[model samples]
Each structure stands twice: as structure tokens, then as C-alpha cells.
Target chain A: MEYRKIKDEDEDGAGAGADIEGLRGKAFSSSAVSNMPPVERSKWKRKTIVTLALTVLTSSQAVLIVWSKRAGKYEYSVTTANFLVETLKCALSLAALARIWKNEGVTDDNRLSTTLDEVSVYPIPAALYLVKNLLQYYIFAYVDAPGYQILKNLNIISTGVLYRIILKKKLSEVQWAAFILLCAGCTTAQLNSRSDHVLQTPFQGWMMAIVMALLSGFAGVYTEAIIKKRPSRNINVQNFWLYVFGMAFNAVAIIIQDFDAVMNKGFFHGYSLITVLMILNHALSGIAVSMVMKYADNIVKVYSTSVAMLLTAVASVFLFGFHLSLAFFLGATVVSVSVYLHSVGKLQR
Target chain B: MEYRKIKDEDEDGAGAGADIEGLRGKAFSSSAVSNMPPVERSKWKRKTIVTLALTVLTSSQAVLIVWSKRAGKYEYSVTTANFLVETLKCALSLAALARIWKNEGVTDDNRLSTTLDEVSVYPIPAALYLVKNLLQYYIFAYVDAPGYQILKNLNIISTGVLYRIILKKKLSEVQWAAFILLCAGCTTAQLNSRSDHVLQTPFQGWMMAIVMALLSGFAGVYTEAIIKKRPSRNINVQNFWLYVFGMAFNAVAIIIQDFDAVMNKGFFHGYSLITVLMILNHALSGIAVSMVMKYADNIVKVYSTSVAMLLTAVASVFLFGFHLSLAFFLGATVVSVSVYLHSVGKLQR
Candidate 1:
């Protein structure tokens, strides 16, 4: 499925370029009637709404997932379950689309037919997604949430590289600089001045985090390229196929992990309400992340996630009775500046 | 969005009839090439694959969710988290669609424009989804997994009623009989011959289960109506709006439940790796349920779920040392018969 989308990209790139130009021209013409102010305002408004939604959803996902695990004190390995959950998430998207089609009386048989035809195009990305999620679960085993937050920023750089190579989209020098500043900001913001806690984290965890970051970068870029390949296709239609493959991939993962145990004992032996809630949180965050990727770029996703981490830290001060250090404030400032620069760079480009 | 779909159904019924007729003619003309053999064989093959997939995914979801809760031993209320999870599911669907658009070079500018224009349509269904999910969490709290599974069969009847009234779709007499048999089978199968377990469940749990069934029925029918109304719209585009509203609705639910603790303490506390796994499980189930709904209908979804419950029961015999009563086998026989009858009826129709 992934290969098909990439192939589609190669075949369709010229058409897409022409379409983008046409869209730009349309935007220019529309400026005469609407002027830039209202349109820009609405565009910004939409972006803000999307960004904030992503931030809140993702942060909540991280927090709730961690908290649920703590509350459950479960001893089971999470990798297989994670794969299963990823698969389920895809199924849910497909279901949602079906529901929409049934209720809305919108008949585009062509689109539906095309969607099914394209089902063969999603397996690669879905497999990549499964691997990335599995690695993420492993990373949680080693790194504290705060450390994980900081290390994940490495994806921004990886995404930049992937973006250039895969999409052949050039980043301006300023944009490149912004990427560096974004990384620096995230590192500063998540810096733990507390020596004891810092030393407690295993070196293996850090290594895992870096690898996870690299994986995330590749996955994010790959997903973006797939979406870009068929920019005009119904997003939901494409998602349906992507998720179909994802579910299949995860099923294999679960079966391979321990077929006998999963089949005989059941996949959810020691689960609780908290565990269910945690799964829910992860699913939501997945959606939020995908949305950010769709409307913006991987860089924007990274920035929004960073902002979420910042919010989480501030939130911790009151919720957990943690005291903020001076270094924390300094990091927050630098990160904020970097975010502003990145946004400005995006606008200028 | 729900209302729009419903309205569209009313408006487009004639057009749909014509389209169906047109399609039938096409099918008739194509029949000369191979008669029924190849076509029938392929159709049956597809159906078998889909049904098997649905059964496996749904069953795993049920077992894992129940097991996760049991393992956690946590006593916290799941209402707020349920809302958050529900919201997140929608967001995830949206994100998936967006990612697809980004990857696939399909650019329908009008589709994007129309998607935004239709944003106001999703809140009603989104809210309905929220309510149904919340009720489900409560049902889980009161009812044990096995009991929850059996009682949920009530939705089969409710769905039939709702389908007739909302979607104006009629069930064959055989289909209705199948529904009745399905309910009876589920009850008989779950009936505890063991006195100790039999007396333990509260009446309130039964009542909650009933309500959850009704809600499920309504939500399922309503969603089907919405989707049927807009068969032509991009499922992902529509999903994006639906999720946007769903997130908003969940945000309200979270705030109304307890604004201060959620906001100050943040949503995640006492979380661990296991909790994350459990969340992943729920998300996967959600997807599976959706997929079943999309590919088949509510009847198929109910049947698949029932099969999952039976699998879970059998698994418990091996994993949890539970004994399967003779009555369970008898009930299973009846349910299987009903499923076969329903499938035949659908084919005849």
C-alpha cells in the first residue's frame, strides 16, 4: 500500500504542482472580494483551533496513559497490546467513515469504489506506524515522560531531512535555522537541573529515545508523502485503507508476539477501567497527531507537541506540587521564542 | 451533520432508487460472462474474510478491555476519562484523514471548501456518540464482562426498531426472527448455572446494561442514517468535522465533570505502562467496531460481537479455569443458527 502511494506520488507530482499553482491563483483572485484580512484571520483561527486541540489532546494522552499504568500496576508486556490497539484505531476510522456515508446520504459510488480499489496501497505505512508505536512503548519503559518529551524533538531534524529527500521540498535557510532553534528550545525546556533524577535514567533509555525519534521522523515524513501523493482523494477514504492495513499488520504482530497465549488466555487478561481509559487517551492522541500532520507539517506537529510538553510542565506545578526551577523558566522562554521564529518563517515562505 | 444526512436521505431517496435500478441492470448484463459461479465464489470469499476479521478483532477487544480493568484493581471513576477517550477517537479519525490528504496528491479544492462549510453538521452525532460511550463505561462498571456481552444483545432489537424508523429500512421477517433468536441465545449462553456467580450481579447492573443497549441502538441507527444520506461525500472530510465536534463535546463533558482537578492536576496521574496498553486496547476495539459497522451493518456487527463473547467465554475456560455449562453450548448453537439464517435472508433480499 505504501509503495502504491509513493508510486502515485511520482506519477501525480506534476499534476499536483499544477493544482497548487491554480489554487494559489484562485487565492489571489479571491483577495479582491474578501481581502486578505478576513481570510487570513479565519485561516489563523482554524490553525489555532487545530493546534490547541492537538496540544491538549496529545498532552492529556501522555499524562493519562502514564497515570493509568501507574494506577494499574500491571505486570504484562505492552508491545502486543499496543499493536492490537493500533490496529483497532484504524478500524475505528473506517467505521466512522461508513457511519458518515450511511447517515449523510452523500452518494459518491465512484469515490467508495476508488477507496476499495486503493486498499492495496496502505500496508507499508501501516507497518511503519506499527513499528514506531511498538518502539514508543519500549521507550516508555526506559525514559521518564519528561526525558521522552525532550528526546522526541530529534524527529524535527529527521523530519526535515526526510521532507527534503522524499518530498523534494526545499526548506529555506531561515526554515533550517528555525528547525535548529526548535530543537535547542525543546532541549532547554525539558532540561532537568535536578542531578539525582537525571542520573537515575538508564543510558539504554536515552539510546532508545533517540532511535524512537529517528523512527518517528521517518514515519511522519513517510505518512506525509503518502497523503501528499493523493492530495485530492477523500482523506477518510485513504485513511480507511491505511487503517485496514494497519489493523492487519498489528494482528500479525500480536499473533507473532505470542499466538498461543493471546488466543488461549485472551489479549487483555489483567486489564482494568484505568487501562481502558489509557487506551482511549492514546487513540485520541493518535488522531490529534494525524490532524496536525495533515493541516500543517511535521515541524508544526513537533512545535505543537513541544508546546504541549510545556503546558504539561506548568500543569504539573499545581497538580503534583512540584516547584519550578529557574532553568525551567529560561527553557520555556527560549522555546517560546523558537516557536515564534518557526511560525514567522512558515509565513514568510 | 446528522440532521443534514437525514434530510439528504429524505431528498435523495428517489435518486437512490434510480441508481440502484441502474446498478441492478449493470449486474444483470455482466451475468452473461460467468453466470453465478465465479462471482458467487468471490463474493462469498470476501464476506468470509470480512466476517472472520470482524469476529477476531471484536472478540479480542472485549476480552482485553475486561481483563485490563480486572488486572488494574483501580477504583477510580471512568466517566471523565471515557469522555476524553471518546473525543480522542474522533480526533484520531480526523487526523488519519488529514494524513491521507497530505500523502495522496488528490486535490479537490471544492471538497476542502465544502468540508469547512459542513463543519456545523457534526455536533449532534458527536454528542450522541459521547452519550452512548459514557453510558457504555457505566455499563462496564456495573456489569461483568460476560454479562455485559450478553445484555448488549438487546441493541439488536433496538437497532431493528431504529433502523425501520430512522433509515426507513425494513428488516425481513426472517431477519427479525434472527434478532429474537440472537437475544435468546446470548441470554441462555450467559446464564450462570453456577449459583454463586448467578446471585452476585446486582439488578442495577442489568438496568444499566439495558439502557446502554438502547443508547447503542439509537446511536447506531442515527449514524447509519447520517452516512447513508451523504454517500458521495468524502468519508474522511466528513469524519474531520464529526471529530471536531466530538472533541468539543468531550471537552464540555470533561469540564462539566470536574473542571478544576482535570485542568490543574492534568488528566494523567498515577499512570503506568500497563494503563497505556489498556488504552491501546480500547482504541483498537473502537476501530474494529467501526469497521464492522462500515463494511457490514449493525446486524453483522452484533453477530460478530456475540461470536467474540462466545470466544471469550471459551478462552476463560482454559485461561481462568471457568467451566462451560451445557446450556452455553445449546445457546451457542441457537446463536449460530440465527447468524446463518440472517445471512441467508440478507442474500435473498
Candidate 2:
């Protein structure tokens, strides 16, 4: 749900004067935030922070997966990791909700009833999340980190399309053009040099990446639509249910994959502490993605992912001793230009 | 900041009619939420869901950790895990911010300026978080999972005291009593039988747990005070800075611990996939804790933690083959009563 709607409804429902007076005593204590005009503190700062967080976290996850594959010590199935990640994320979201309840004191009895009533709507998005997560692992297997990074940019275009169709949110012509440029820039940046035929990626990997982009795009847009539909609801609360269903879906997948392997080996079989860190990174990235979707939109998420890909490439240079090609710099420059154009276009609108 | 204030200010700043018309088109399209009064949605449902989620996740983390310790494969130092967890969490928070930006379209030039303006205020809380997280590892080392669960309840009292002293918010008599009962119930629930003293716990563990509680109490309450001080600020934005400082602190700590070893062994030294999951679980739980503190009061967080402890205990029975004590049942009953009493007290107030 949009943050503004929740704030507006709270004022209307509680009576603005009384609410303000109450908040003034509690919120306007001796702190830097108390003296500022409310308008100056824009919600965009929060969204940007979340998006950046997601990018960094997800990039780390990507790096870890690539590193693990290179190490060849990680023998767990992708589905197993996905299951673990989903379960962990679901639990984490719930914990976040509890903290929110304790600190904000915003939720009351009536809200609880409505949340129960709305339980039916969560399964769809949760299912989509499960599918997307599973696809992500598969995609990782098919392509190298840099290749996956570039190809995944397809989500930007797909997300734009989905935003228009599912959320019925029209994109400006400039926005559409920017998306195309983003895709082209990402592809160019990750393209292998013709002389270096050392690492040829399979065609199936490219196909899987494209399908992943599509699934993620639709899922992201659909989630946004659901959340926006109830602007007055707590985003974290809705997220808790979304993760719950996601966990359920993953649980079934894990069972189908092999209950004995999971049971006998335990969740950490053949896993070292580094693997745990990667999973944690993955889980946090998941939370970050949802936060972005809830607060901003799929387009912003795509940009963040693009930025993350660049960061990942840079990190690989230092960590893996990988060389960056000239094409990469050219791609980076194009992506920067496109991002600038999109921002300017948005401002004008 | 509290979510409600942002909405009220937006209405006043942008003009109510234009904003509502704009929202109506985007938020009201064929969704179930359009027909209902915003007030009916309430916040409790979200709070309850989050709390439940936290309980499940935290419990699982506890169980996994205990299992790992028993497995003897977790050779990596707790400090290493702590460092990785902090960094990962920081990145995740940023990613979440990015997603928020994509969805909300709230950031503009002015908002960017204000966000930059507010950067200086985050370091204190961020440092506090680093301290608290490090202290948690120390606490975990000293105490068993169940013992840690019981003694950690002390934070409820400390949090209440800090909330009053720092935030200048008064607590009702019933709320105070509920807190007392909560601590008592948690203590009693996890009390071990003298005859079954198979695991000899040291007095140092208890001391460390109490110290950890005090730090957490102060950190939780102070963070709340800062957040409340600016009701119009975005929580995710604030979280970003807090995490940034935390990451910085952890970096310094890692260097101090032994830079060469970390670099040589790599951060994943002796770690398996399970270790990665544990770290992921820990990071998410940390986010959950902060979220609880941000959205609700520390008291509710205490309650949520207590519930999580119970869930952990229950899970241990199945997974770890631990027997549930009669005292555990009694403690659960008492906790339930206190929860009911607290809810009723809140309603009356």
C-alpha cells in the first residue's frame, strides 16, 4: 500500500487535531526531525533507501551463488535453497511485523478482523513469488553472473508492460524509450569479447533468463496492484501473509524434491558458514524487493537491479580478478544516460 | 516516523481534493478495499501477523543455531558471522529502500535535499545497533537457547524505563503490571528442573544475558524516540542510515579482530550452506526486531519475543527431542493471560 494513504486515513479516522496533539507530545520530542516541516520529509527518501538496499543485498546474493558454484562445494539443490530462503523470509517478515506492532501502537482490534477477512487474496501472489524464486536459481545455473546480470535487464521492459496491463499504469513514451535503452545498455555491458571465446553460455540459459524476466515482471506488477488496492493497510502486514503463502508453496516443493534428503542431512548438510551468509543475503534481498514493490514500483526495482549488476561487476574485478571489457564501460555510459533521461522525463510529467 | 502523520501532511500540502481524486483512480480500481471505510482496516491485524511471523522465524533460528552448535561443524567464529550478518542486513535495508522508491514516486529534488540534510542523525542509533548485535553473539555463546529466551525478557522492563525516560511517554499502571507478568511468566516457563540438571549452565551466562537485555532495551527505546521525534520521516530511510553506520562499525570490528585471517580464509571460511541460512535467518530476525520496535512499543516486542520463545520450545520438542516441562505449559498459560490483560488494558485506555 502507498504510505501516504495510510497516513491520511489515520488522520481522518482519529480526528486530525487530537491525533496531532497526541503525536506532538510523543513524536516532537528533542530530536532533529521534530522541527522540520512535514512536507520537507518526502517518502521518496525511504523508497530510494530500500531500493538501494535491495540492489546491494541481491547483488551480494548473486556474487555468493557464482562464487559457490565456482568453489563447487555447494551440493544442495536449487529448490532446497529456494525453500530455505522462502521459509526464512516468511519468518523474518513476521518478526518485522511484531516489531512494528510494538513500536507504532497503530494496529487496533478492528484492523485485525479485516486482515483475517482479506486472507483469501494472498495465495496468488505467493504462488507467483515461489515460481519466480525457483526460476531465479535455475537462471543462475544456466548463465554466468555477468551474463545473468545483463539478460535480467529484460525485466525492465516486461515490468513496464505488466505495469500497463495489470496495474493499468500507463508509461510515458520517454519512459518506454528509457526501458529499451536500459536493456540495450545492460546487454552491451555484459557482452563477451569476440576474441575471448573461452566462456560460451548455453542458449537454454538465455531462454531461462528471459522467462525469469517475464515471471518477475508480472509478479512484481501484480503485487503492486494488490498492495495499492488497499493503501490504508500496513504494507508489512500484507507482506507477512504474502511470505506465509510463499513459505507454504516452497515447503511443498521441498517435500516433492526429497523429504529424506532434507530430513537426514538437515537444512545445513554440506553447508559451511559462508553458505549460511549467502542464504541470509538472499532472504534479505527478497524482503528488499518486496519493500520496493510495496513502496515504489517495478520500474524502480529494475533500475536498482541494473545498478546492482554494475556493482557486482566491479566487485568481481577485485574478488575474482575478472577483467572488465571496453563494451562494459560503453554500456555503463549508456545506462547512465538512459537513467538521467528517465528522471528528467518523470520530473517534467 | 509514524505512518499517520505523513498522510495528514500530504493532504494539507497537496490539497485534499486533488490528491483524493488522484488516489481514487489508482487505488480504487475493482479492488475489495475500495468499498470499505479506511478506519475499518485497523493496524492490529498487521501487528498480529508480524508478531506471529517473528515468533516462527526467531524460533527457527534459535533451533538451527542450537543444532549447529551441537553438530560441531560450525567452526567459524561468532564475530565473523556477526560481521557478515550486519553487512548483509545493511545491504538488504538499502535494497528495500530502492524498491520503495520504485513503487511510491515520492522522492523529488526537495526530498533528496531533506534526506541529505538528515544523514548526520543516524550514526548514534546505528552505533547502538552494532553494539547490541555484537552483544547478542556474546549472549548466545554464554547461554543455552532456552536460558537465553527466558532471561532476555528483562529487556521488557528496561525498555519500559527507557521509553518513559527518553520518550517522555507515560505508561499506564496495567501496562506496567502486564510487563511484570510477562517477565515472570517467561522466567517460569523456561525454568529447568533441578533433578534434570543435565546441562550445567554457568552464572556468567546469566550475567551476559542481563547485560544484553539492558543494551537492547536502551537501543530499542532510543531508536523509537528518534523515529517518533520526526513523525513525517520515512522509517526505511532512517533504517538505511542506521544500517550504514552499523556496517561501518562492523567493518572496523572485523579489521580489529584479524584482517589477514578473514582475507585469507575468506568470510565464508569453514562455512556450509546451512551456515548461510543461519546468517540469513539472523539478519531477517534483526530486521524483524527493528520493525517491531519501529511500529509498536518495546512491550509488544517483548510479548512477541516471549511468544517466539514458546514456539522455539515447542519446535525443539519435535526437532531436538526435548521434553516439554509442566512448568512450560504453566508459563504459556500465564503469558496468554498477561497478553489478554494487556490487550484489554490498551483497549480501555
Each model's C-alpha lDDT? Answer: 0.53, 0.58
TM-score of chain A of each: 0.73, 0.76
lDDT of 2 by residue, B1-349 (tens): 1111101111101100111111222344325334436663334334444555566666777677667766765666445766677677778876776777777865641132345546776666656645655565565555555555455556767777877887787765445655665565566565553312212447777677666666667766776666566655666666656666766776776786547778887776777776788778777766766665555555666666676777778888889898765445545655554555455444335
DockQ of each: 0.01, 0.01
Q: Could you list the chain B TM-scores for each candidate?
A: 0.71, 0.75
Q: What C-alpha lDDT, on a 0 to 100 scale, does residue A286 get in candidate 2? A: 70
Q: Which stretches of model 1 miss by more than 4 angstroms?
A: A1-46, A69-72, A80-84, A103-110, A115-117, A132-150, A193-211, A258-265, B1-349
Best by lDDT: 2
lDDT of 2 by residue, A1-349 (tens): 1111101110101100111112222333425345546653345446656766776775675577567767765665445666676678778866776777777765652133454557787777666655655565566566655455445556767777888888877666445655665665666556553312212557787677667767767767777777777776877676667777766876776786557887897765676665677667767777777677666776777777676777778889998998775445545654654565455445335
